[model samples]
Every structure is written in C-alpha cells, then in structure tokens.
Target: MNDFTFLLPTKFVFGRGVTDRVGAELAAAGYRHALVIYGQGSVIRTGTLDRVLATLDAEGIEHTELGGVRPNPEVGLVREGVALARECGADLVLAVGGGSVIDTAKAVAVGVPYEGDVWDLFAKRAKIVAEGKLPVTCVLTIPAAGSESSASCVISNDELKLKRGLSSELHRPVVAFMDPELAFTLPAYQIAAGVTDMIAHIMERYFSSVGPVPVTDNIACGIIHALVEEAPRALADPRDYDAQANIMWASTLAHNDIAGVGRNAVAGGRAGGWECHGLEHELSAHHTGITHGAGLAVVFPAWMRYVWRSAPERFLSFGRSVFGIEPVDAEADGVDVTPEEAVADAVTATIDELQAFFVSMGMPRTLGELGVTADDIPALLETLEQNKGAVFGDLQPLTMDDARAIYESCL
Candidate 1:
C-alpha cells in the first residue's frame, strides 16, 4: 500500500434508464446553454437523441449540435466545438457518444480558454485552468476508454498525423449519465474494440508498480475477470443488460482508481505506461481501417512479453489471480514453475483471444493485414514522440529507441 488520495466529485447516474435524470441534473448544475457533441447519426437511429433532447427541452437548456467527431478525435473538431460554444453562449459541453465524443468535448473545454493553438496542450505547453476548459458532461453510449468521468482526452492532428492526449483535473466531467440501452445500437466490431480498450486501462495500471496493495490488486483482478466473462456474453447478445451493466461499471471503476486504492499503490502516478495506446493511436492515425482497441490487443501483450521480466511477480499475480493461468513455462525451463510464467502465458493467450474475437466480429487482426506497413511505423513513431516524456506515463519509460523497437516489433 502507498499514500494516496481519491477525488471523484462527478455524480454517476448509472443503470438502464438512469440517463433520464440528465435533464434535471443539467438544470441543477446550472448549465443553460449546451454544445451537444456526437458522432454520426447512430444516436438518432437509436432514439437516444430524441429522448435526450426531450429531457433537455423539458429542462429548457438550449444547445447547438456538433456532429461528425471522428474516432481518435481531431484537434480541429475541438476548435469547431469551442467556436460553437462561444457562438451559442453554451455554458455546458455535452458529449453524447463513446470515448471519442467525451474526449473531444474535453479537448474543446480546455482549448476554449487557451489563446494559442490547442496543439500546445498535447505538447505540454499549457497548464489547465479548472475554470478555463468549458464545463462538460456526457450521455455515455460506449463503456470503453473511461473518458466520461476522467480528466484524460486523446486528440489528433491531421498535419502531424499524430494522436495524443490532454489531461488535467480540470478536464474531468461534471457528471456522466450512462444508458446501457444505447450501447445496443453499437456494431459488433465497435463493441469488441470498446471492451479491449477498457481492459487495457486496467492492465496498464495493474502492471506499473512492484509493490503491494492487496485490495487494489484484487480489484484490478476483479475488473479483468468481469471483462473476460461478460465480453462473450455481450457479443452473443448486445441486449444483455446485465452483462452490459457489469462491463460498463468495470470500465468506469478501472480508470477511476476506485479499486487501486492503498497506502503504497503504484498508482498511475508516473509508472503506468500506455504503450499499447501509443501503438494503437499510431495505427488508427495512419489507417482508419484498424480500431484503437484491436490495435491495442495486438500491441499490449507484445509489450508484456518485452517488459515482463521487470516485475515477474506482478505477472504471476495477474495470471493466477486474474485469469487462472498455470505457470507451465517456468517448469519447462528447468526451474520451479512461477506465477510469472502463468501470467505471461495468460496475457499472450488473452491478447490472441481478443484479436480472434475482433476477427470473429468483423475486424482486422494484424498490422500488415490491415494495410499498415513498415513505412507507416516511422510516421507513427514520430507522432508518439510528441509526448513530453518518452512513454505516456513511464510504466516502461519509453525512449525513442524503445518506441521505435516496439513499433518495429509489432510489425
């Protein structure tokens, strides 16, 4: 256990019909004008848009519509939303899709206050002012990426061909209304990608530290278990509300640090590296063919293989406790079998399983197969280096060489 402090001020209204509360909550929160951000018309087809707008109409909140936010959100779109907010006199920024929507709103919120280009935020040149970024909330349709309640947003630039994040306590949403029913409208590939991305959040946090936090470890393990179990169920029937609810809660809990709390927790402090995200971001930036989550499935386990030796015990714990993988490798190595081997094998198997899951759900499996090439790796590496530090949060303290090697290895 380590010294830690938890801060989650946003009200989470969960469950099937819980989103109906958003209209009254927005009024209570003093949001009069809103920028309703969403992707294409999927929300409209699902009737979610009508229900949400009706709620807002009842509450008398005026809003401007900003749609067409792409996956891996763009900085230009953020700017567009900022302009919309300014023009509409919108006090609230309402994100109505999945991770991309929420993240885009976050970028717009932060960018509105900064006089310079929003790219500065990605470059680590801007300090977030809590009051600066437009106040934002979400009607979450996807359970992946945990962006709804977090202060993290991944944004992209077309000229740079780069995707990076802007995070601050100031970026956290004021409230998040989750409706599992909306998720039913998502395609199978989208569902798979969301699940993979959500689990990566936990894996990154779980593998960072070398110390002990039994409770936190258990909670991380529990989230993984929930994901592994519910993923198949949800894919089989998108209408499985219980399965959807479990995964929805797991995704939120994983990133919110609700589980990883202890006196000596490794914390996302600076150790939890998002190498998987870097790889996936580059892939998504270059080719719209691969979803962020599928790329993560390929890259994350490879990362584990590269770095597992740093803290084998952590692997062992993850394997035995989380996935029930047996340590067969160490025994074959002429040493006493260890949980580390089991963990590593478990991760490899799970990543492969996830990739296969993607293929089954109509997604690409490999970098080369997706039309991503060795040529693209160089540009992707360039985009990844835009971070202030080598790695996203230092789980492995990525360097240019290390990042290059990871991309090359993924090939």
Candidate 2:
C-alpha cells in the first residue's frame, strides 16, 4: 500500500433515461449556453441528438452544434470547435457521442479560454491551469476510453501524423450521463473493441511495479473479470442491459483513477508502465484508420511476453488471481520442474489465454493482421523512441532494443 489522495468530482448520472436530464443538470450547474459536439450521423439518425436538443429547448438553454468528430479526433476539428464555442459564447462544452466527441469537447473547453493554440497543450509546450478552462460534460453513447469521467484528452494532428494526450483536472467532465440503452445499436466490432479498451485500462494499472496493495489489486482483478464475463454477453446480445451496464460502469471505473489509487509509488509514479499504450499510440497516430483498441490488442500481449521475465512473480499473481490459472505442481505432468518453471508456465498460460480472448473478440493478434509490415517497424520505433526517450515502462525499463524486440514479436 502507498500514500494517496483521491478525488472523483464528476457527477455521474447513470441508468436508463439519465441522458434526458442533461439539460437540467447543465442548468443547475449554471451553464446557460452549450456547444454540443458529436460524431458522424449516428446520433442524428438514432434521434439521440434530437432528444438532447429537445431537452435543451425545454430548459430554454441556447446551444451550437459541431458535428463530424471522427474516430481519431483531429486537431483541426478541435480548433474549429473552440472557434464555434467562442462565436456562440457558449458557457459549456457538451459532447453527445463517444470518446472522440468527448475528447474534442474537452479540448475545446480548454482552448476556448486560452490565448495560445490548443496543440501546445497536447504538445506539452503549455500547461492547462484550471483558472481559464470552461466546464465540460458528456452524454456517452460509447462505453470505451472512459473519457466521460477522465481528466485526460487525446488529440491527433494529421499533418504530423501524431497522436498526443494531455491530462489535467480541468479536462474532467463536470457531469456525465450514461444510458446503456444508447449503446444497444453499436456494431459487434465496436462493442468488442470498447470492452478491450476498458480491460486494457485496468491491466495497465494492474501490472504496476509497486509494493503489494491487496485492495487495489483485488479491485482491478474484479473489474477485469467482470468485463471479461460481460463483454461477450453484451456482444452476443447488445440489448443485454445487465451486461451492458456492467461493462459501461466498469469502463468508467477503470480509467477514472479509482482502480489505480493507492497502488502508485508515494513519490508519484504509476505502478504499471503505460509502455503498450505508448507504443500503440504510434500505430494509431501513423495509421489514423486503425482502431485504438485493436492496436492495443496487437501490442499488449507481445509487450507482456517481452517484459514478464523481468517481473515473473507479478505475472504469476495476475494469472492466478485474474485468470484462475493454478500453478503447476513440481513433477505433476510426468516431468520434474522447478518452482520457477511452474510460475513461468502459469504466466505463459495466462498470457495465452489473454491473447485468445482478444482473438475471440475479433481483435487482431499481430501487427501483420493490423496491416503493419517490416518496413513500418523502423518508423514506429523512431516515433516511440523520440517521444518516450531511451526507455519506457516502470515494471521493467524497456529501451529501444527492447521495444524493437516487442514490435518484432508482435509482427
């Protein structure tokens, strides 16, 4: 266990019909005008946009709309949104779609009040102080990324082929409305991808290089188990409210820093390394069409295999606790094996099971499956090496050579 302070101020309005109260929630929060941001035609086609607009109209709240926030939301669109917010004199930024939409809204919220370009914030050239940012809120239509309740926003720049993330308490949503019913129409692929993203968030925290924090570990394992169990059910039957609700809430809890609290070093570093996410960011940044979750699926297991030897005990613990894989007894399989061999076997089985689960969910198991080739590896490694410097990960420091090995293994 470690010393920590936690604060989750996002007003989470969950359950059925909670989205209809978005207007009232904003009104009570003193936001009179909102710049509503959304993605392509789905919200409009489903009448979700109309419903939200009607609620705003009933509440006499004025608004402006910014549509067309794509999968890997671009910096140009975020700039346009900030301009629209300023033009409309919007007091709040409300996102009505998925993570991309919400992230765009958060960027706009910060950009609206800042004099400099918003890219500076993502580029780490400027700090996002709380004094100037507008409040952000969301009506989540997708359960991935957990951007609805998170303090982070990721934005991409197409010209540079870069995807960067910025984290600040100012980016956290003031309120989030989650209606699992809204997710019923998602395609099977998106559902699976979303669940994978949520699971990755927990795994990133679960594999931290910190002292034993039993409570946090238990919570992380429980969340992963819940998602692993419920995701397939939701995919098989999108209208399965129980499964949908469990996944939806788990997504929020995974990234809201709740599962990570008290597990980090007291000196302030994440227990688990985000090396996989750092690597996957390069993939998605170069190939904007690649799904974030799919890229993660391809990279995470490979990263695990490359690093597990450095922290075999941790992997053994994860295997036994999360996957229920019992360690092999010495000489149990008609072969004499040391205790170390037994632990390694359990860890290998757990990683295999994880990769199998990703495959079962229709995720790509290799970079080749994701359209990456031998030629692409160099550029990807360059991007990662530049951004991450010489090494990545805390559980086991991964230098450029280690990263190259991981990418090669993924291929």
Candidate 3:
C-alpha cells in the first residue's frame, strides 16, 4: 500500500427516521439559523419538508427555504442560495434532497463566506481561503453521488454548457442523516441510475495506475460486489431496508476518498483516472436532460473498452475480483489458447457483463441511445477541451483524439 491520509469528519446518523434528529442536532451544535435547500416538490410532496420544518420549529431554529435545485445542479441556483444564506444570516446550510441539493448547499457554504464570485472557486480563478465556512448538513433522499459526506461538489453552468467539480475539505458536510426509508419511494429508474453511479465511483478508483495496493483493491472490489448483490434487491423492492441500507452506505464509502486514498498518486501524476466522469460530465452538461448516472452508464463501459488494452492486468484483476470471472485455463477448455488470450477473454467477458448489467437496469448502452449522435461529438469535445484541457485520465492519458475515438466507439 502507498502512503495516505484518511480524514472523514462527517457525523453520519443513519437508520429509519434518523432525519427526525436534524433539528436537535443543529440546535445542539449551536446553529441558530439555517438555510434549507432542496430540489423540486418531491421533498414537500412526500412530507419530508414538513417533518423537517416541524423539527426545526420545535427546536426554535430559524430557517429559510430555497427550492428548485435541478438535477446536475446549476451555478445560478447555487449563487442564489449563497445570496439567500447570507441574507438570512444562516449559520448552517441544510440540504434535504439528493446529491444535487447537497452539492448546491456545499457550494453555497463556500460562497457565503467568500467575497468573490462562487464560480471563481470552481473555475480555478480563486481558492477557498476562509478559515471558517457555513456548516453544511444533509438529509439524504437519494443514494447517488455521495455528496453528503464527500469533499467534492459538481455544479453546471447552463450558459457555458459545462459541468465542473471542485474538492475542498471546507465543502465536506458537518453532518449527514441517512434514512433508507427516505429512498423507498424513489422510482426504479432513479434507483438503478444511483446504483450505476456508485459503482462507477469505485471503478474509477479501482482502475488507478498506482502500485498494487491490495487493501484498497480488495475494499473496492468488495464494495462493487455488495452493490451488485444489493442493487437488484433494492430495485425489486425499494422498501427492502437492508438492501437500501447497503447500497446507501456503499455509495458514501465509494466516493469519500476512502477507496482512492493510497492510489491517488501514479507515476504520471494522473491519480485515480476519472476519464469516464470527465467525458460523461460533458454529455450531461451539454444535454442538461441526461441523468448523470445514466450518462455514466453509457460512457463508462465504452471507456473501459477503449482503454482496457493499456492496462490489461488491471482489467484482468477487475474481471476476476469484481465480476467473479475466473480466467480460463491455458489448455483446458480450448485448443492452444495462450494465457494472454485467456486473460483477454476474461477481461472482455467482464466488460460485456458490466454492459449487460447496465442494460438490465434499463440504462442505455450507447451514446446514440442516450440521445447523442456524431453531430453532437464536436460540441461535446469542444466543451470538454474548453473546460478540462485536451487530455483526461491517469491510467492512460486521453488526448482530444483519444476522446474522439472513445466517443466514436460508443457510437
């Protein structure tokens, strides 16, 4: 294993009706006023909003409400949230929806204390230098993105057709309430998309070009196996609290820097290659209608197909560990098949199995199926190049031409 540091300070309260403690927790933490951020009418319609409001009222905590945070989240809404948080003098920013809402709240938390434009932080024009930020917390209603306990937050700019993410310890939530029951009412498609996103999170770290960090690899593989085992059960019955709990916790563990701790540094300084995420972000950023996880479902396997040749051993390990696909014997089941050929076959089968899993979850298998075409490639590439330079990924640094080829292969 490589040298690494792990510091996760988020106080996670998980179980049924754990959200009921949000008010008392905030009050005990001495947060006098909070800005409650949420997405559409789901929170309100499901009565989650009312429950939260009543809790706050009981604890005598003042709060301001900000709704309409869209999926993939927008910089405009984040700015508006920051403004409202400042106007209300909110000491805490409480997100009451999924990843989008939590990410927005994190952005707002950072923006509320900084004097410059919030976009400057994400665009790399400025840094978060404040010693203190508005404390952010969440009541997770969706189990994707793992933003509730992660340092990273992704926000989109509609005008720029760009989605960008920034990671800073300041953005990590101070508290996160996870109640699987909250996700029981989620649609099957959303659950599947969340599952795919969480799996991609682990895969991104697992495919790192770093040394053989057996511990990290095993943990990543175990998380993938657990998700593979539990996602279907949760999808079949959203009320299956055990399955939902497993997936929910796996989502958090996948992206909380735990899986990629020792694997962040490779010889090329590429760290955990997020090539697929870089590509998928552009797709979602430009299209706006494409779900983040659904786009990932389409892009990740295509990315694997395009780049697996660069790191066959890593791919083979993934095949054997995550998918439980053992390599064929060199001479047993076939006529003069080399060990290399056997490994290659195993890797191909693993990728095919992953694609099939995504399909079984009702995810599109191609960019075309996700509503992207050859004509969209130029625009997508332009966005990617403009936002993230010419190349992406650490496992195999992908240049513009490489990205084009990956998109073409997907088509």
**In model 2, how large is the Cα lDDT of residue 49?**
95
Off by over 4 Å in 2: 266-270, 331-335
Candidate 1 vs 3: which has more TM-score: 3
Candidate 1 lDDT tens digits, 77-102: 88888777777777888999888899
> What is the Cα-based TM-score of model 1?
0.89
* Superposition-based RMSD of candidate 3 using all C-alpha atoms, in angstroms: 1.6
| Candidate 3 stretches greater than 4 Å from native | 266-271
Give the TM-scores of the predictions, in the order they appear.
0.89, 0.97, 0.97
Error of 3 at 34 (Å): 0.5
Worst 10 residues of 2 by lDDT: 264-273
lDDT at residue 38 of model 2 (Cα atoms): 95
lDDT tens digits by residue: candidate 2, 1-411: 877767678989999998789888787777899899999999999999999998898888999999999998999999999889888899889899999999999999999878889898888888887776788889999999999988779998988777888877677898999999999999988988888898888888878788667888888889988888998999899999989999899989989988888777654444467788888999998888899999999889998888888778788888888789977787666668888888888888999999899899999999898888878888888878767788778788889888888888988
- Candidate scoring better on TM-score of 1 and 2: 2
Clashes of 1: 9
Q: By lDDT, is 2 or 3 better?
A: 3
For each candidate in the order shown, give its overall lDDT on alpha carbons.
0.75, 0.87, 0.89
